[model samples]
Target: MTADLPLRKIIHIDMDAFYAAVEQRDNPAYRGKPVVVGGRPDSRGVVATCSYEARKFGIRSAMASSQAYRLCPQAIFVKPRFEVYRDVSAAIRRIFSDYTELFEPLSLDEAYLDVTVVSRCRGSATLIAKEIKDKIRQQTGLTASTGVSYNKFLAKIASDLDKPDGLCLITPEQGPGFVERLPVGKFHGIGKATEKKMHELDIRSGLDLKRWPLSLLVQHFGKAGQHYYDIARGIDHRPVRNFRPSKSVGVEITYPEDLAEPNLILQQLIDLMGKALARLTAKQMTAHTLTVKIKYHDFVQITRSKTLPQAITGVEGFEAILADLLKDTEVGVKKVRLLGIALSSLHSPELLHYRQTDLFAFSMPSHFPN
Candidate 1:
């Protein structure tokens, strides 16, 4: 099906150690040193990002700050300055706009750009990628790695082939062989759990995945099996949408000390919900579902959720739902390490009014984590 569509000239650009790099660029003292950005080493916070120097010491994002400290005792830990990062990201996007409007931002640090129709640089995606990288370096004083390919899947993969300040081009002729030789674990969107499942099925690489029949793959992996089949053949039909809608908004916090009391847990959830609601409102969106997540100190996790008959317009709409969702969990009986609230099935009230359609029939899970 994907083969019938015209080939796209896509480029994926990812900033190298974005948060840490911004910190280093702003503070001269942090240059050439192992820098960790996030919570303090003594706090229950996780590493948001770390410098390449810290990565050599086996430090990684999402690792416990204490563990990161243990790995690199000399690592300089600092809090994230999100406002500065957002400002830099806006600047980066302005650069992207100069080349093509068909760019989809995956995050503040990365994006997919479809330059198939762009006439700049003689329509050479490779040259455009190089120019983008150079412009980013010149504008932000930070390095970006870029990958140019005929599709988003290959483009994204190519971007990661080299690091820090790399520019890789994967031609149409090389795409299939590249996928065939690639490890399934290295494929985008295949998480560790999915990779483990694929390995147990003897699907160690793209070649092995390609050998499986689509029906059998579907039986094992459901709808995602089709995606695996397509990507294994170096085919991805997904477009680079410039105006992607918000699917969900949420916030979570990991506490320094576990809370055993129900009231304390509820209070923490209320605070998180408040933040999530504020984000939703800021986006001019409302949600029809509320989900509460609790993680025990032992890493055991459980979630409780409720769907309303109408859109949730304000905090008062979901405050009672929070307590109700908590009742379904072991919040009072278990010592909680993390608390989260997610508002899903989001819809812009103005859009709903314009379409004059009911939004209660749909529900989607929130993808963002605090």
Candidate 2:
């Protein structure tokens, strides 16, 4: 609606079926075959990601491994090799830095680049996106989909318009009409629950949402209503930040089979703590809170956390807290599907500046492991 605002050049780069593609690239046998990368089919595992081939049979990420197996019995299921993926992610990030320093990584395989002032490819954001796609293919032997737009929301939407080595763009002039035709559920922050609510209100698309009064939206969704209103009009002013400080670091694992034994769960916690602690130290951060999470076989998840007077800097301190939090849960009594330990209330030299900045604040000031 407003034409006076500065036009920012934003691009969203998403690797095409990242984890599944990596597996296929490294192992030639997986090529042209459906590959699911995550937990095994016999366990309580879920699909992390799947090849487009798997998608033909409706296999998707977060689906139960067993269900995926049932969908396509011939599909090859493999465990995740995060270390290899991490290496590839790092390599791609280095490639991103060559174009512009103003990029935010959403995950290992997805990132948003703000190249409003970038000079590479003669300052053409579209060309920049094309070059990036080419470089990723050359360097990592992987294909990525790129979306070029004036903001993150539209850019991300454009990226998904095409898949598996596709490039799409939505210009400022096209933003309004593009969003109007988009489904409410396809909007970035609108999840399944919100989509259901939108359906009840007949707010099925961006055009439908734009018709509702701001007051009505707020009455229905509280603070999130403002976001809905802004996005409906194709308004998103969020910046592409260069630095993202960690609020916490932790490690977690989902068991192949539900473990009901205290000793086994305890051992898993210990292992998780080691990885968590190592990550915390690697980031030069300290935590004052330790939280233990347990998910039972029935899918009920609970967390117990303790805030210490002093920051924990060693494994022994973390172990003590873990033991206490574990005791607070009914892990041994119920079959546990997943166990996780997290250290929060984090502090580090890198975060100190943001902590002191009055402009910055976390709505939820705690972090959890991915």
lDDT of 1 by residue, 251-298 (tens): 777666777878656655765665566556544578998888889988
Scored against the true structure, residue 342 in model 1 reaches a CA lDDT of: 91
lDDT of 2 by residue, 121-165 (tens): 667777777777888899999999888777889888878888979
Which regions in candidate 1 have their CA more than 4 angstroms from the true location? 1-3, 250-291, 294-328, 331-370
State, as a TM-score between 0 and 1, how close model 2 is to the true structure: 0.76
Give Cα-based local distance difference scores for all models. Answer: 0.77, 0.76
TM-score of predicted structure 1: 0.77
